[model samples]
Target chain A: MQLALESNAFFWAIEYLATFCCGLLGGLWAVRKRYDFIAILMTVWLTGLGGGIIRDVLLGIFPPVGVSNKGLVITTLLASCAVAVVYPEVDGLKWTMATLDALALGLYAVNGTQKALMYHTSGMTAVFMGLITAIGGGLIRDVLLNRVPSVIGDSHWYTVPALIGSVLTVFSTRAYARGVLSFTGELVCDLLIVALVVCLRMLSVKFDWKVPGAIKRKQYRF
Target chain B: MQLALESNAFFWAIEYLATFCCGLLGGLWAVRKRYDFIAILMTVWLTGLGGGIIRDVLLGIFPPVGVSNKGLVITTLLASCAVAVVYPEVDGLKWTMATLDALALGLYAVNGTQKALMYHTSGMTAVFMGLITAIGGGLIRDVLLNRVPSVIGDSHWYTVPALIGSVLTVFSTRAYARGVLSFTGELVCDLLIVALVVCLRMLSVKFDWKVPGAIKRKQYRF
Candidate 1:
C-alpha cells in the first residue's frame, strides 16, 4: 500500500494542487495585511507548507519537503507575487477562493492521513496528523496575523469535515490492510473521502452552519 | 562534542530549568486569560515544550522529548496546576518572573545552538535553530492568544539576546572543533554565553530598551 501510494501520480497531483491553492490563499492574506514583499513571501510559504512541515517533523522526517522542495518553494513565491500584482481583482473572486480553499483542505486531509498511515502510525495518530496537515498552515497564518484561529474560536464547521475525512481515510486503509477492500477500492475510497470533505465544507459555508457553544450565549465576563 | 553534551548533567539541568520556567510563564498567561483548567494545561504544554518540539522535529528527532519524556510532561502539568492555585500571589512576583524568563531564554538559546551543532549542522543553520528554539514557544503562545508575536511587532529587545547567544555558541563550537579550545573550554563557553544572554536580557528589561521601528511615527493608512 505504501509503495503504491508513493508512486501514484494522482497522489502527487493532489499534493501539488493543494499546495497551490493554499499558497494562493496565503498570498491573499498577506496582501490584505499590507505586508512588505518579503513578509508576503514568507507568509505564503508558511501557509502552503506549514502543515506538511509540522506533520513530517512530528513523524521524524528530516529537512521536511516544505523547506527542501524547490518546486514548492517556487510555487509559494509565485502565488505571493500573483497576489501582490493583482490583489484587488483577485479579492473580488470570493467563490473561486472559497472553492479552492475547500479543495485544498480536503486534499491535505486525505494526503496527511495516508502519509501517516504509510509511516505505520496508529489510526488515532493518523487522524490527528491529517487534521494538522489540513489546517496547520491556516492556523500559523492566523497566528502570525494576530487573529484568533478560526478552528478553535469560530462557530463555522471548519474542522468537522477534515476530521471526518481523516477518520474515513484511516478506516478505508485498515480495510484494505485486512484484504476486505481491493487496491482500486482503496483509491476510490480516498477520492470519495476528499469529495465528501469538500462537499461538507462548501455546504457549511453556503448554509452558514456552525457548531454550538458549550454554554448558552449569555454574556459571561471573566 | 555530541557525546559529551549528551552525558552532561549540567546540560540536563539547563533543559529542565528552561522547561520549568517556560511552563510557568505559559500557565501564568493562560490564567490571565481566564482560561479553563484544560485550556490552561494545553497552553502550558505548548509554551513549555513548543520550542523544543519544533527544534527536534526540524532536527528529525522522533516522538519529540516534549511528549515522550514522562518527566518533562509531569513538570509542565505541575507548573500549570501551580498557576491555577495561586496565580494572584504569583502574579505579584514580577521581578522573579522576569529573571526566570531571562534565564530560560538564555538556556534555550544556548542549548538549541549546541544541539544543532551536535547534529553537524552549519554554523548559520545552528544559529537559526537556536533563535527558533528560544522564541518558538512564546511565538506559539502569542499566536494562540491572537496577539502579534512580540519578536516581530514589539519594540522590546526580546530576540536580541537569543540571536547573540546563538551566534556566540556557533563561534565557540567552531573554535572547539578546530582544536583552539578544550572540551572544558567549550563547556565554559556555553555557560558564558548563557550568562551573557541572561544579563543582556535583564539589562534590556531594566532599561526599557527597544528596537527601533522601520518608519517614524507618522500616520500611514493602508
Candidate 2:
C-alpha cells in the first residue's frame, strides 16, 4: 500500500506543523534551562531539524533536506520565538505540549523509516533511522544543554515507542511491496502506529514507567 | 612534494594512533563522570570516531569510514579498556593528553578540509567542514557529559587554528589545481598549517589564553 503522506501536499504541511511543535518544545526547554534568547534559537533549530539531518546524512543524502529547506528553517525560528513569548502565560500547558510533542515524534518516526526503506536500507537500518529521526533533535538539544540524552537514560519509554512504530513501518512496507497488504491497509497501519505511540507515551508518563538501566542510580552520582 | 600521510601505511598508523588517544581520553572522561563501564565504552566509541562519522555523513559518504573500519573500532575499544585500567597512574598526565589531542585535531582539520576540497565544495563550506571534523567529537562528548561545548564557549583557541588551517588547505589546493603552486609547495603548506595549529594550541594552553565571549560572566548566571 502507498504511504498516505509520502507524496501528498498534506504531508508537507504536517511535517512543517511537526517542526513548529518540536521547535516550540525546544524553546520551552531552553527557557526552563535559563538559557538566553540566542541559545533558545539555537536549541529550536537543533531540536526541530537535527533528526532529519542525521537520518539524511546516514543515508548519504547531501545537503540534508533540513539544511536546504528554507521553509523549515523559518518555521523553526518563528515557532521558537512564539514559544518564548507565550511561555510565561502557559504555566499549565505542560500536558498539552507533551501530547503535541508525542504526536510529532510519531509522525517523524514513521517518515524517517519510510525514507530509509525508500533508500533500500535493511529493515534493521530503517528501524534505527526512524528512531534517530524521532529522537535525534532532542538528543542534540540535551547534549548542547549539557546532559545525557533522555533516550539513553532511565527516563520514560521515549525510544521504545518510536522503535515499535518504526518496526511497524518497515514491516508494513515490506508486506505492501509483496502484495500482502493493500495501499489502504498500509495507510491504516501507519495511522495505527502513530496512535499506538501517542497512547504508549502518555501511558508511560502517566504511570511514571521508567526503563531500567544497566547500572544502579548510585553509580550515576559523580 | 606529496602529502606525506595521504595514502601511506604510516598515515594509517597515525590515524589509528590518534583514534587510540581519543578513545583513551573518552574513557578517562567517563571515569571522571562516574559513568559505568558500558557508558565508558559508548563514550569511547563516540569520542574516538564521532567527528569523522559526522564529516563523512555531511559529505554524503555512506556507512561512514568510522563504521566500516573495523580497525578503528577495535582501536577505540581497546584504548578505552587500557585507559580504564591505567587511570590511577595517569593523574599527572594532563599535558600529555592535551598535546596528543591537539595533534589529532590538527590532522583531522586538515584532512576534512582536503576531503571537502576534493569533493569540490566551496571554500567556506570546506572551512566549516574542517572545523566540524576537528571539534565534532569533543562537542558530542561534552554534550553527553552534560556540559557546554568548549568550542562554543570562551575556552582555548581550539577552533580558530583549525579554521586557519582549513582555509590554508583550500587555498593551497586551489593554487595547486591552477598549477601556480608546485606539488612540493602544496605539501609544505599542509605541513605548515598543521604545525601552526599545534603550536598555537600549545601556546594557548601554556599561556592560559582565552577567547573572551561577547557577554559578561554575570549574564551566564542562571
Candidate 3:
C-alpha cells in the first residue's frame, strides 16, 4: 500500500515547502514582469502546482495533487501576498530570482524523482520524470505566456542542477535496492543530495560550469 | 485512418497548412515581442504542433504524429521564416493577425474533432478534446513566454469560434453516420465553417462586435 514506508511524512512536508518556495519565486517573477496582484497570484499558483497536475494527468491519475491539496493552494496564496507586500525591499530582482530559482530547481528535481519512484518507475524513466517535474511547471508557465522556456534555453545551470538532483535520486533509490532503509538515513541522503545540487548550481553560476559541450546552437534556413 | 478514404491525404494537407499558419503567426507574435529569430522559431514550432503532440501522447501513442510528420516540420520552418522576413511590410499586423488566427482556430478545431472521432471517442469527449487540441499549444506558448493567454484573457470570440467549428464538425460527422452526406460534403462543411469563422472574427474587428462579458470577472487580484 505504501511505496516507501517512512517517507510519507517527509514527502508531504517537503512538497508543501516546495510549493511555498516556488510560489514565492513565481510571485516575485510576476513583479519583475510587472503583473497585477491577481496576475501574480495566478502565475504563482500555476508555477507551484502546474507540474504536479501535468505529471498526474500523464500518469492517468485524477484530481491531480494540485487540485486536491489544500496546503499547496494556501501556500501559493500566502506567497503571492508576501511578494506583494515585501517586494519593494528585494532589490536586484534578477539576481534574487536566479538564486531562489536555483534552489527551487534543486528541490523540485529531488522531489520529482522521489515521487516518480513511488509510481514504480525505472531509474531512467524516474530521472527523466524528475527532471521534467522540476522544470515542467515553469515550462508550462513560460510557454503559455508565449515566451521561450527557461529550461530549454541557455540559462545558468537550469537543467544541470535538475539533472544532478534527478541522478542522485535515481541512484539513491537504487542503492536502497527497492528494499527497506532507515528513515534517518534516507532523509540524510535526500538532504545531502539537495545540498549538493544547490551548491553545484551556485558554483556553476560563479565559475560558469556547463555541460561541457555546445549547450546552445543556432540554425537558419536560406 | 482506414476510418474513411482520403483520410491520409486530407490530414497530410491539413497538417502542412495548419503548421504554416500557426508558425507564421507565432513568428509575427515574436517579432512584436522583440525576440531573436531562434526564439521566434522555437515559439512557432511549439505553437504549430505542441497541442497535437500532447493529445497523441495522452492517447498512449509513441513518437507523436506531430513530431514524425516532416510536413509539419518543413511547414513550421518555412512559415516562421516568411513571417520573420515579411513582418515589417505587413502593415496593420494586429487586425491581420486577428483574422488569420481566427481561421487557424476554426480549421484546427474541426481537424481535432475529426481526429477524436476517428479515434472512437464519444461525441462529447471529442468536442472537449477538440477544444483542447485547438488551444493547448497556444496556451502553452503564452505561459512559457510569460504573457497572458489570448483565448482566456481577451474578451473576444476566440473560444466561441473554435466552439462553433467543433459543433459543426460533430454535426457533419453525424450526418455521415446517417448517410445523408458524402465525405466530400463533410469537407465542404469544414471549409465553410473555417471561412465563416474567419469572416466573423474580421467583421467583429471592423465593427467593434467584441463581447464584454468576462471583463468584470477578470477583475481579480491581478
Candidate 4:
C-alpha cells in the first residue's frame, strides 16, 4: 500500500511537471504573436493546467486551477519564466511546441485515465475523460486563439489515440483490481498501452492520416 | 408550474442568444486576424459555445456545445459567414464586442445560478458556477491568445459583480419557487436583479474597480 501510494505520488510529479512544460511552450507560442503579457500568462496557465482542471472539475472536484494552489502556481511560473528568458535560444520553437504538445497529450491520456478509474468511473467514462483531458486544453486554447482546434480539424487520429490509450489502461487496471491480472502484468500492460498511443499519434501525423469527418462537402466554389 | 417551466426556458433563450453574440464577435475577430475560412468558423464556434461548455462540463453534465445537434454545425457556419461578410461594413466592432461580452457575463451569471439551483447544488456552488460561466470563455480566449485574462488582470469587480447577479437570481428565484414571492413579484425581482448586475459590471469598468489578488512580487513572479 505504501509503495502504491509512492508510485502514485511520483506519477503526480511527472504529470504536473509535464503540464508546466506544455504551458511554457503554449505561452511562448502566444508571446511570439505579440499578444499582451496578460494573455501570454493566461495562455501558459491554461495550457499548463487546462486538461487536469477539466478532468478534476468534470469529476465534481475542486480543480487546483480554481484553488490557485502553490504547487501548480510555482510549476507554471518556472516554465513561464524559462520561456520568457530562453525563447531566444531555440532554433525551431514551433517544432518544440508541437513535440511538447504530443508529450503532454500522451501523459495526460494515461494519467487522466488512471485517475478516473481510480475514482471508480466506468471504462467508457474513463476513456471519455482521457480524451477530454488530452485535448481539452488545446481545444480551449485554439478556441481562444481563434484557431481551428487541432483535435477537431483534419485530425491525425489525435483524439482516437488518446481514447485507445485510456481504454487499454482501464482494462489492464480493472483486471489487476479484480485480482485477475498480476501486478507485473498490469505494469507491462500500462507501458504497452502508453507506447501504443504515442506511436499511433506519431505515425498518423507522419503519414498524414485522419478520421473522415461526417460530411465532406465542396459545397461552394462559385 | 407550467409558467415556471416557460420562464426557465425564456431565461435559457436569453443565455443562448447572448452566447450567439459572443460567437459572432469571435468570427469577426478571426477575420480581422486573417485566419482561413475554417479557422474563422472555429473561432466563432468557440466564442459561442466556449463559456457554456465550461459551465456544463464543470457542472458534471454533458456539454451542450454539441447538443444543439445538427444546428450546432450549421449555425456556426452561418454565423461565421454572416460576420465575415458584414464585419467590414460594421462600424465600431470593438465597442460591439465589449458590449456583448458584458451582456454575456450577466446572462451567464443568471443562467449558472438557475441551473445549479435546478440541480439542487448548494447556493455557494451556484454563485461560483455563475462567475465561472460568465468569464470562462473570454478567459480561455485570452489564454489561447497568450494575453492576460481580462477579468483576472485589469477588470476589477469583474467576478464580484457576477456573484451579485447570481445571488439575486437564485434568492428571488427560491422565494418564488417556494411561493413566498408571487410570480409577478418574482418576475419584477428577476429583471431588477439582471438590471442591477449589468449596471454594476458596466459601472465597475467605467470606474476602474478591481478584485484583489494575493500579493505577488514580479521579482518573485512568473
Off by over 4 Å in 4: A1-13, A63-69, A88-97, A217-222, B1-222
Steric collisions counted per model: 0, 3, 25, 11
Candidate 1 wrong stretches, greater than 4 Å: A3-5, A37-42, A53-74, A152-154, A212-222, B1-53, B57-114, B120-131, B134-138, B141-146, B154-222
How much is A49 displaced in model 4, in angstroms? 1.2
Ten residues in sequence with the least summed lDDT for candidate 4 chain A: A213-222
- How far out, in Å, is residue B71 in model 2? 8.0
User: Which regions of candidate 3 are displaced past 4 Å?
Assistant: A1-48, A67-103, A110-132, A136-222, B1-6, B35-42, B49-103, B115-132, B135-164, B182-222
lDDT for A109 in candidate 4 is 83
lDDT of 1 by residue, A135-210 (tens): 9988877778777776888767789999999999899988988899888888888888888998999999899999
Error of 1 at B93 (Å): 21
lDDT-based ranking, best first? Answer: 2, 1, 3, 4
For residues B1-222, could you state the per-residue lDDT of candidate 4 as single tens digits? 323323776765665566667777766655565545545655676566666667787677742443233444456667777776666533256666666667777777776777777777888888877777777776765555445666666756768877889888778778877989898887777667767777787777777777766797767745
Instruction: Mark the regions of model 2 whose C-alpha exceeds 4 Å error after superposition.
Output: A1-50, A53-100, A119-129, A139-154, A160-221, B1-17, B20-100, B121-128, B140-148, B151-222
lDDT by residue (tens digit), candidate 3, A99-212 = 666666777777777776776665655675676677778877766555567654554566667777889877776666555655556667777887888787788788875533
Give lDDT per model, in order: 0.79, 0.79, 0.69, 0.68
Q: Which consecutive 10 residues in model 3 chain A have the weakest lDDT in total?
A: A213-222
Interface RMSD of each: 5.7, 5.5, 8.7, 8.5
User: Candidate 1, residues B68-142: lDDT per residue as tens digits?
Assistant: 999889988888888899888778887887788888898888878888888877676687678778988888777
